[model samples]
Target: MQKDIELSGKLGKKRGNTKSKDCKTKTLILGCVVEKPATVGEIFKRTGFTGTYKSLAGMIRTYHDYGYLYRSGNKPFTYTISELGLEHLENPRLAREALIERRQANAVAVTRRFLLGMDEESRNNFLTEMGIQPVEQHVTIAKNEPAKPDKVTVKVLPEPVEKAKNEIKTNTRTEYVSRPEDLELIRELEEMLASVKEENENMARELAGRTIAKAENSTKKPPKVRNYDELLIRCKDTVVGSSFFNEVPYNLYVVIAELTKASMKELLKEKLDDVLGKKDFKKGRIVLVSDVQASALLRYKFVRKLKEEEYEKIKPKVEFRSDGVYIVVDRLHFADRMCDLPQIQRKSTPIIHHS
Candidate 1:
């Protein structure tokens, strides 16, 4: 049956797209998958005008034409990664060393030429665009030769200077009750500059506080407005752990963003576990979880549009917000879903979605 063959081919490509590839192809695939979908033609363009890229594109196109790469419902007609493509990825490339050298040299060139002029965020964006990332970010403190700490001296009071003491007794606390004429005559100018300085400082502080408050209030958006479930799903796929282990069947992400959007503080109900065999995972959405913290998390997902079975596809049990959420994940994996509401619940508070 042509239809069956086509379906199998499409399934195979999908498997490849999801699973295996050479370094460059993986990078290109990841670039497309995380941010947006792409076609074989687009991938060839990204590889630059090279024979290797054209050859690869030709192969991919052939595969697609053969129905090995089927497009999903309203999704782009993209080729999935196939077992054969995956096998190629595991092979050692003859130009591996040369490619590494070129990449390193190019990185240096970028840092010296373009990156120097860019701001921090722009530089990071550039790195991402280039399919590279900064090795590490660090701040160095200028260590001047160590200075000795300040020394404090105690004054022995110079034996209380008997003459000074007597003079103080005589000169101190002049009891001139109601000497208005003397006070008037003794006037020298006393500047009110200190009081003026204090008033200015107070004014500046008040103005700054008001400005910050206004900005914070205006910028914050309501967490209740967006679909929290979709947010979690997006966060999960892209969130590879600090280290990724495919042997582990669970889709463990380094960060869980549902917590950020769901401020359901009353209950912590996001609990998930891989109890069933990975094959049985499809039918068993109800999981027995070990993490009690996840149980206390609130449920915050907008699945009104999703079919009931589709909703159960993800075992999104977690302790949202309260704890056990990953703080950093690859940015491309987590698409920036913006909040459209003008003003959020009064302040920029973090939401810990539990259920």
Candidate 2:
């Protein structure tokens, strides 16, 4: 049984345990490495690993082989996270969620293997214990075989005999007495049943209360929309003289215009640079005309993938207009604010328009 349990990766062993291969162990190992490079002994102690020293060493070797860890030092080998491992640990929430999913899948697989190893009766009992009903096999009988009696019936007695039997039964019923122990047992059983019923009722009430609370939470109104103008002002102030402003690609403006309902002609006519050059623009004066443009800009400039921290930093600066378009009120203003016009000091040159 111990061997089987160990093979099944369900053993409660202190050393050389199969749990070292589990997602939780892997996560712990990565977390420890992220904190600082450590030797095998340090990692095991920090992570509270129950596996043998030899096993821990082997696991570290495996991690190094998989490009998740890099080994350093000779006498007392130290381990550090590789670039790939750092990427995995970059988002702790995603890593933890993935670990949870892996654990659930492993649990299901283990349960299936355990059930498959059990005998028929034991399997049935296991299913019943888990609140599941086992399927029963239907048996067929041959047409030539004699039918088995499920019940037995006796013929009626003669009238005189029947009358005497009825009189005896009536006398017995009239003189029947209940034993003290039997009565006490009946009372106890009734009390137990009542208690069970009350418990069930309490559980039902609790379940109902939770359901109602969940519904209320689901139906609650969303957070109030933030003022776009204020957000634009903040962005303009923060980014105007920042290094990130200079890094903004010139092609992004063309891309934004191409993605929006407004044409390049309209943008040029408005003197795009001048309109955004003003620092005292009124609140709600500028509206976004294209969601595609905003999304494209965000994807190109900020993050192409979902990361909560980066997303939050850029989210406040953009808004989705009711007209199904996304707009950045400060796009032109911020860009214009970044220009060092006085520093140029050169004669005005003819601007070349590239088609």
Candidate 3:
């Protein structure tokens, strides 16, 4: 009775295992087809199935025959899930469980090669870190085998020491130290500033002294008054307006000589007409005098007539003098004749007497 119970239990377990394997294979095929219509080769490759290609092709044909999947294309047959297959997967709870199992299986497969390349201890430690349990069978195999040298070695520093070394290097690079050369540069700059300050002060003092000296000199005496008679005598014998009035329309010299001989006040156009006894002579002379000789004759006449007190006031006003008509003449023409006449020099030198 005990032997029969044990035998029945073993058979039941074998049947249960076979059922689970069939169910997993069907689920993988359904998942691949539901995701996209694919050929037997694509489905097998994507699902990472361990079955032979021929077996997978046979399984795909079987599914199409059972109406669980439908053929979408021919040459190389492509299969997609049918309504019956979709209805089986429509159970939300079962679908979610299947998806989670598929993800876990993929993760295991992806890391399996890397884990196998590691030694037993390292493999266990890596699996532990990844929250996975290392297989006991793998551990037993590792124990039976001789230890092999590691293919790759990695160096890892403690966190605090690595951080401290980085900080020390950064601080050393950033820290600044003053040298003797810098001190020397600063000292030289200070000396230069001091010398510049001294030079500026000396220049300011010298300028101030010069300003005071000029003020004192200005107050001590006025400018020496020029002798107008001496000025006229120096310019005597030179023709008035000779440089600019080279070709006179009339006999300008004759008119000038007549004015000097008369010893009259400077002649206006009307006075010139009266003295020369002809209106035409006055009109012709006007062109010559107005063009070049007006300003010079006016200046001479102004000085000749100015009194001591009047000279000071009118000297500044002479440049702006507007209300006068004077006959232009060469002073040198009269100088020799006037030297013999005491009255003409006496009339011209009033400012000299006052000074």
TM-score of each: 0.16, 0.22, 0.22
> What ranking emerges by lDDT with the best candidate at the front?
2, 3, 1
- In model 3, which residue pairs have backbone atoms overlapping below 3 Å? 236-332, 237-332
The order by descending TM-score is: 2, 3, 1
1 or 2, which is superior by lDDT?
2
What global local distance difference test value does model 3 have?
Answer: 0.43
- Local accuracy of candidate 2 as per-residue lDDT tens digits, 68-180: 78664332455778777776556435555767865665565556557668999998688668655444343332233333342122223335775668544233211122344
* Model 1 per-residue lDDT tens digits across residues 150-265: 31222222245775664542333221122344234323111233343455568679999999987889866323211223444334434333122111112321212232323433
Residue 123 lDDT (model 1): 69
Candidate 2 Cα misplacement greater than 4 A, ranges = 1-21, 90-355
Give Cα-based local distance difference scores for all models.
0.35, 0.45, 0.43
Cα lDDT tens digits, model 3, 12-98, are: 434655545555666677777775566565675567776566777777787677667866322344566877777654542454476
By the lDDT metric, which is better: model 1 or model 3?
3
Candidate 1 — which residues are off by over 4 angstroms? 1-37, 51-58, 65-70, 73-76, 91-355
Candidate 2 residue 174 Cα shift, in angstroms, is 88
Clashes per model (N, Cα, C within 3 A): 25, 5, 2
Clashing pairs in 2: 16-52, 276-333, 288-327, 290-326, 291-326
